[model samples]
Target: MRAVQVTEFGGPEVLTPVELPEPEPRDGQVLIAVDHIGVNYADTHQAENSYLAPSKLPLVPGGEVVGRTADGSRVVALLNGGGYAEKAVARQDWAFPVPDEVDDLTALSFIVQGSTAWLLLRRSAHLAEGESVVVHAAAGGVGSIAVQLAKAWGAGRVIATASSAAKRELALELGADVAVDSRAEDMTATLLEANGGKPVDIVLDMTGGSTTDGSIKALAPFGRLAFYGMASREQPKPVELRNLLGHSTTIAGMWLPHVFTLPGNVFGEAMADLFALATAGEIRAVAGGEYGLSEARAAHEALRARGTTGKLMLDPKR
Candidate 1:
């Protein structure tokens, strides 16, 4: 099997393509002939050992995969690791059968990016009808879907923010009511202006640093902000609980892995809903560039540089 391995902690340059022996499945696991692998920001963090969890040496840096099982079932699995290869193993419970109406890339989209977008809006933010929303980094995988989901779920207004005009334009195409500059000098003012000079009800932010601070400042009374990732590689100013008393605002943190710990089908239920939406043509997955298994380095380089939009993918068989 051909795979990309990271032996040292650094950047995209560390991902090396190599030939490795095929992995065997255990009792509860099934072997998959990988078709397409989903690349995510977490993959970059995993390669550089900057993720929430520490990674071991010689790690294969992909988690979501769309492949065929030994029984000829086409499925998508979200694994712990080792997805960047021609052959990978996934636990039976971790793999879900992809609907015939959904293509491999579309199924791959919902596993990590789509699920997070659903949980961020439906669970963490507790979105309500007729409420305003702010989606940061709105052209990326999670952001792109979040923008559409916010509107589909009956948000009164959806404001999208992105670093470039082209990305913002894509957000608007995805159903965001308004698009604003994410690199604005005053993010709070930018958001307020986009929302018709009013505070927003919900905000989904993955970019940390001042963006987080600005989102908090722009929250309306009882507004909710779901902070998920620190894409900016910077931390926001320390927050004071005392100040939250004024607006009764709430800041909730979401880590997808933790949601799995709850004794329910949270992950599965979300995946099913996303797949249905994709099948019904209610939402479309925005795809970025596709890379072969060997071009993993270039994929990571583009992702880390924020030079790509939507979902980045790798073709393991290529």
Candidate 2:
């Protein structure tokens, strides 16, 4: 099996392809012949040795994959690492059967980003029908999914923020009622106006630093701000506790791995619901680009340069 490894974290140049022995599955685990592997911002963080969790050196940096089990059944799996390979071993419980209706790359792209968007809209923020939502990085993997999920969930107004005009237009195409350049002055004001001069009921914030602070100010009373990703590379700023004095605003963080730690049935139920949504065409995974396993380095570089719009994948069999 060929895999991309980061022997020492630094930059995309560190992701070198190498041939490795195939992995065997243990009891309660399944071995997947990886067809497509999803690449995310998390992968770049891992490559640069800047992830929230400490990563071991010489690591194969991938978190989500779509492939088949030994019996040749299609499935998608979430892993701690090693997804950028031709083969991977995953816990049986962590793997979800891919529906015949979903293609391999689409299924792989949905596992991480789709699930996170589902959880954020349905669980974390408790998004309500006809309420308004504001999502950052609306052209990226999770952002694109978040926009669609927000609309499907019946959000009356969905405002998306992106860095460029092209990305802003893409966000609008993905179901955002309005798109704003977060880098512009008075972005919060623009977002509020887009929502009919009312503060949003929920904010799905991926960019931290100053943007997080601004998002807090843009929330409605009793609103929830779900802080999930930190793409801005800015140190977290202090929130004015006084800002919440008259408001019932709350800040929460989310990690998908925590879902696995829930009681057995809970994890299964949520994933099943996610799959159902995908199968029903209520949500679509955006696979931005595809590359062969050997081109993993180029994929990372694209992601690092913010050159891609949606989810990126590596086709291991190519």
Give the TM-score of each candidate: 0.98, 0.95
lDDT of 2 by residue, 190-268 (tens): 7778788888889998788877877777789888899888887786677677767778888889988887766655556
lDDT of 1 by residue, 1-318 (tens): 899998999999999999999999999998999999999999988988989999999888888899999889999998889999998988888899999889877888899999999999999999999999999999999999999898889999999999899999999999999999889989999999999999999999999999999999999999999999998899999989888887899999998888779888888899989988887788989989899999999999998888789988898867
- lDDT for residue 184 in candidate 1, whole number 0-100: 97
Candidate 1 clash total? Answer: 0
Q: Name the lDDT value of residue 280 in candidate 2.
A: 88
- Model 2 clashing residue pairs (backbone): none
Model 2 alpha-carbon drift over 4 Å, by segment: none
Model 2, residue 78: what's the lDDT?
A: 87
Best by lDDT: 1
